[model samples]
Target chain A: MSPLSTLTPRTLKKPSPARSRLRGGARYAPTLATVGLFLAMFAVGAGMYPSFLSGQVFLNLFIDNTFLIVLAVGMTFVILTGGIDLSVGAVVALSMMVSATLLQQGWNAGAVIVLVLLIGGGLGLLMGLIIQYFDIQPFIVTLAGMFLARGLCYVISLDSIPVTEGFFTGMAQAQIPLSGDLFVSPGVLLALGIVAIAFFVLHHTRFGRTVYAIGGNEHSAMLMGLPVKSTKILVYALSGLCSAVAGILFSFYSLSGYSLAAQGMELDAIAAVVIGGTLLTGGTGYVLGSVVGVLVLGIVQTFIAYDGTLSSWWTKIVIGGLLLVFILLQRLFARKAG
Target chain B: MKSLLKHRLAWPVIALAALLLLNQIFRPDFLGLRMQDGHLYGSLIDIMRNGAPTILIALGMTLVIATRGIDLSVGAVVAIAGAASCAYIAASPDPGSPVTAATAVLIAVVAGLALGVWNGFLVSTIGVQPIIATLVLMTAGRGVAQLITGGQIISVSNDHYKSIGAGYLFTLPISILITAAVFALAAVLTRRTALGTLIEAVGINPVASRLAGLRARNIIWIVYIFSAVCAAIAGLMISSNVTAADANNAGLYIEMDAILAVVIGGTSLAGGRYTLVGTVVGAFIIQTLTTTVYTLGIPPEVTLVFKALVVITVCLLQAPKARNLLNRLKAAPKPAAKEAAKEKVAI
Candidate 1:
């Protein structure tokens, strides 16, 4: 029997209620917590200024946070496979540059999008191939990928390029009206649709099962003939596609693309995925959890912003602290689970 | 002599010669050694001086990697140490006092030790993977540094601190001497002591090592603490060189370089069988490659792509399967076609 065979049956365990609650914290827990946190902030903001919780204020969250949701979805897929894509932020920068450059040359928006996706996916494919075929460490390979992608972005433009195309600007600025005082941005809907599709694919597809399998035990997955290398490569490619899509959302939101735009956003995506209860070692994660994680992070930042006294560096400190805590929690879980 | 020619170092020695030859052809001025102000001055010396931190990090990384673990937090620890020492100096009444210097060094070392302990505890007792454990510090350590500096770069004009990074000793750069001393100390600690054997045993097979009466956890803890201290020293060098503590960019991406140095030195990431000398040589190779790229007028952006290519090629050459395939291809070309077909189908 294989060394992992002993743990196979136990893998089907229905986590105890408390354990399930911990894992499910990203879903139900985040909602309640976010609501409570939001109300507290809203009350404080109202006390400081009476119109802090206005409809426009609420709409700002969707406008500002839509790109993060898309990025988080891509991160979720990568983490589900027990791998990471540190190069996502770089890919976003690269894709944005590609789109910005192409659009400047009068290429059709559709063509620009296709070009960015193909380039991003091609980079991802190269990274995945190196990592899988050469048996190189994923972290190093992705680190190199990060450098390569970011370098290309710099080579395209050393600084920010304002996206001047009217149609591109209009598409990015387009807003969707909702009932009553609430309005949803098109980017928000796009992010939500991607998340929903990600949920369906992860929970209801054989490919998702293969990802879980690979994360659980690569050797076992190989023995079971589960197309391990192809799965690994495909997930990276998906991550690249997601990054490109997020780049579009970001460009629409900001109407600019800069090489340094997403310098450290990869860390945010990582923290979100981990906070959502995804194991860094792979296996056992949910896309919805990542959405909640991103919201939690976003809300925390909003709270910090409302304070007006804290430096932006506090975001790093808070995320870093929470990351440490979640990692410790994961360690504890692994110890108990082991 | 014949056996020495067959030694592992022979490959790197030959590679170094080839690199020099290539440099002489492309940039002949690179081999032009000279002396200035009673000090040896040349590209080689410049490489050593600038690469002091990397070489120091790689030596410690060698020991850590030997335990089948890595220290991604070293770069962060460097920032933390730099911040700690700088803050201590800036806030002190007598920054030039020996006591202040000692206290600052002590405090920085202690902080780094504490950080390492947290990482070790997570990896050994709490069962977090080494990479993940160190990653926590890798992310948080910078935050701690930022918090220490109050989000500002702290500048110091202390001669004592400056000497550590830029001062001369016996007509040579202090950084070089400090690095050499640390390397020697590491060599003695690993080669002249049983600790080295224990670390190797633990790395090779922790369970077996434990069954054989070794405390693998304690060993891991020691190695982490050691790695952190090395990072502290590097931090001192960096801050002293600039006479200011720039927490934001200090030791950025150093972890990658350290890993690269260790790998190029022929040390396996899978652990066991430490290579102190090889790692030092690897550090030299990386530093030389950087300088070479600059001298060759390659744009800084293309440097990373070039590095990526080099690292991939190195890893492929190191891969056993690749080596076997190479051998098989050389012996019988027919199997190469078959293997290529298999790879295409697999993709």
Candidate 2:
């Protein structure tokens, strides 16, 4: 027999149960790190500003980061499958523009929202199809999608359209009192619902496991007879749905939809996903981790605002630093696991 | 004739020629050039001058993409380089002096080198994905530039500095001259030396190249650094032409333009096999398209829509599946048995 055959059989043997468990734990280490980092940052903020320790302050994190949380959750699904959707920000902008334009034309708000969501989903499906069938890189295909969506947004309207209908305004103003001084808006509740649903879908479904398998090794996943094509397409479609939801929430948040809204928000989502412990290379991440990542970003911005003397741009710098550190940590974990 | 038609650059060159023809049809004087003082003046000259920055960046991108890697941080590097050089000039005791201007350029180029090293280290040594690694810089580099410029656009009034961007040299735009010199230098360095083959080898198969005793890591590292330095020079040209450094807007979307140029020039984003000549033609096509948008009286806001349409068309046409479909269409109505044989061979 060839030496290769001898070595192959030895390596192909199943790993020990304990060793496999260790590997599994190693996979979640980055997510755990993200959680720890979030807590530490929150604690530091509370120490710096006593007001930050209140329930109201905590609620504000969710309220402020509602759109980002939705985007991050959607991005997590895409990233988990070892693909990326750079068009999320542009799709968000397009959805906002479409909804706002229809709303301004006196269309029913509910009908408009559904229409926008479909448009977003369809666009994502198109990109997913091209990327899957044509063997194109996700980066280029999504980049093209970004340009197309942004261009379409501009084609729809060059100026911001304010939504003054009772439906949108009521949604924007509606709030649930959490305590004496804190309240959660409809947008926040919607974002939390998305997070919960994403958590369930990612952790409890075979489709989710298949996504992980594909990220781990596409060829192996194929050999195992997993439906790689459908799952990949579904991941992008899910991301598109999430972007549409986030855009609707943003409309409620700002009460206006401009073509330029959510500029660079995709990067922000990617950064959040990375910080939350989702590996850029895919296969290991948590939905809850991504929510924590969004909170981390929101808290950082709040802290900067409270400081009053610091530049707001410091938020970006801090996020960039966090991304670098987490990516490095991922490298370390990967090395140890190997 | 068939072989000539099959040349990699044939499509891009034809595209460029078609654009020029379209321009000429609209404006009779599109090709007319007259000596204004010692400098040439015409639409063609404008195309070269405006396309210089893109040509510079795409030249570097060609090599980087050839190595199965990408440098998305070039746009951020452009902003930072402009910020650094302009800030230095704005603060100098004698901003108008040649020495000060030289110092500013040196500082900007050095900043580029440092940023390149950082990217190289992250990607080559630490094993971060290129997109994510460059993204770290892309996100933060703008903030760093903002810090350098004190959250303001730094405007300078120096003839020597302005000349690098807006001035003419030997009856040609200095920007065009610089682009040409850089292109020639890169062609010589890559083709004359063994660097081109090594980069292609690594790109084609990193593990195989490493096993064959090539320094893959070093090659990867050098390309990232070279890409950044080229972006830095382009940044200087932009800021110099405007005589101001707007950190927020400087070199925005430039990376996309460079990548598109490289792709349109028939270079594969999947890595390996690049052409400098094709890149030059691609850059001219992009610049010409921008000029056409203006000449056609298309709204500036919708220019991106047209650009996206063109990019999609080019990419689809270049896709293997699309090409095969087109070939099959052309072969329809031929002998069925021969077609079946061809299909079998393809499979």
DockQ of each: 0.53, 0.60
- Candidate 1's fnat? 0.50
lDDT of 2 by residue, B28-123 (tens): 888899999999999999999988988999999998899888888898899999999999999999989999999999999999999999999998
Cα error, residue B292 of model 1, in Å, equals 0.9
Residue B163 displacement in candidate 2 (angstroms): 0.8
Model 2, A1-338: lDDT tens digits are 65555676555546656787888799779888888887898899889888888888888898877889999998999998899999999999998898888998999988999998999888888888888887778888888888888988888889989889889899889989875867999899899998988888877888988988888888899998899999999888888888998999998888898998898899899999998988878888888889988888888888899999988678778888988998999899889977
Tell me the deviation in Å of residue B90 in model 1.
2.0
| TM-scores of all candidate predictions against the true structure | 0.89, 0.95
The CA lDDT of each predicted structure is 0.81, 0.89
The number of the candidate with the highest TM-score is 2
On the 0 to 100 scale, the lDDT of residue A63 in model 2 is 86
Fnat of each prediction, in sequence: 0.50, 0.54
Which residue ranges in model 2 land beyond 4 Å of their true spot? Answer: A1-17, B336-347
Candidate 1 lDDT tens digits, B122-213: 77887678887787778777888898999999998788788889888777889999999999998998899999999999899999999999
